[model samples]
Target: MKKFCFAVLSAVMLFGFAHTSFAEDMSPKDIMIKNFFVNRVKDSKSESAMTLINESGQKRERKSTGVSKLQKNGIDNMRLIKFISPADVKGTSNLMIEHSDGDDDIWIYLPALKKVRRLVSSNKGDSFVGSDFSYADVIGYKVQDFEHKITGSENVDGVDCYVIESVPANNKVRQDNGLSKRKSWMRKDNFVTVKGENYDLSGELYKVFKASDIQFVDKENNKWQPMTIEMTNVQVNHKTIVHFSNYKVNTGIDEGYFSQRNLERE
Candidate 1:
């Protein structure tokens, strides 16, 4: 008898074989990779409302539209988000482009300035449009940016999940993300992240994140999307909740839509 070895060359193939008997034997890196691409579609668009609550219980609501599309390589992604309501923040937009081997590019357009400003790596941990979520959270952390290990298993909303802990791979990564470590509860069945805890530079709990109202957006591709996402700052007692609606996937969005010119449009 001869033994043979197989390699997972793509995210789709990796997901396809993840449900087999080898699931239990998969490495933490592979699991993270699967989670990163779980909801990866050719293109998607949606409208969402973000509610920000302060420690004093005051609330501010913002409406926005978002569009994302994968590049030709199918690994990198380009995203653009434009705020549509609230006179103070209206016409503000953000554009992000993912890089497979280096730092992601982020740009912000302010209606008042009428110019696009690029965000440096140090700004990755900064609040996204004054929300509890950061730029890194909006674009997502790259799988290779951290070292991951399965700490344990738990149930999230009655769904079994793998408790994976991730730490920055280097000091640069740590400073860029402003997180010393993070723990995520990834669904066992579909690899969607149901919950997460982000640790600060001092290794203390900083924020709690949760995702709910899961929807099977791309049934043909076995993809799942979360309709609601919440991030709470524990130390400050502030929170941000975003509810997404009217999600459209595989819409063949044009690549030019993510351009800086479009991002600055009113």
Candidate 2:
């Protein structure tokens, strides 16, 4: 029984290696989106810094406490709470995640209203809180949602980066669901997604995310670590940006942190 179990596990791992990544053979989009959604995070209490700008020339910033739970079945459920201004989002929680199966769900809890609101919209490209970035871009995506093809590699800011294009699949289940298209640039050496371009409903370039300051936080090895990440909406005139800082990767946050009860609380 043990040998049989090992055989099955080995085969499964091999299959994932084939379809998911053998980085050397990985398509740029495959490498990028995979890491964005399924990369294991540091297990610990982490925090993030967010900056928001709007078309009206107004800017607001907030800091949040983050807890990440990576499930065995290729799912990452993350909860973020705004801690800076209590009244602003006090007791509010945002559920950001990606699942191996099913459409990704983004939910927000409003403290004032004491309501949990699902952020789904008829338009998946809608801006998040008026920021230049759509809510879809911030959350990672399922690997099966799109067709991945390697477009080649090029030097991006002096780093050898893999470039891949992503297009929605034609399967009837996902046809015309509002995410038109996207492109990604993944660094070759570290396998980290450095930048991404989001297309509008009409397949027009609209936003980009740039990642940087990648340093090994726990340093057990290079595979798991935290890095500062920043995203800007370029076609929206570069008027908006979101920044991440003080990132502690692989701190091994408890899985219990992701329970539905906690999702409803502070």
Candidate number achieving the greatest lDDT relative to the actual structure:
1
TM-score for every candidate vs. truth? 0.92, 0.76
Candidate 2 per-residue lDDT over residues 95-171, each given as its tens digit: 76554444566677776787778766323456655555555554555455677777888888899987878887763
In candidate 2, where is summed lDDT lowest over 10 consecutive residues?
170-179
Candidate number achieving the greatest TM-score relative to the actual structure: 1
Could you tell me the TM-score of candidate 2?
0.76
Model 2 CA lDDT for position 242: 43
Off by over 4 Å in 2: 1-15, 18-23, 27-38, 42-44, 55-57, 119-124, 171-177, 218-221, 224-226
lDDT of 2 at 105: 64
For model 1, residues 205-227, the per-residue Cα lDDT tens digits are: 99999999999999987778999
- Regions of candidate 1 where Cα sits further than 4 Å from its true position: 1-22
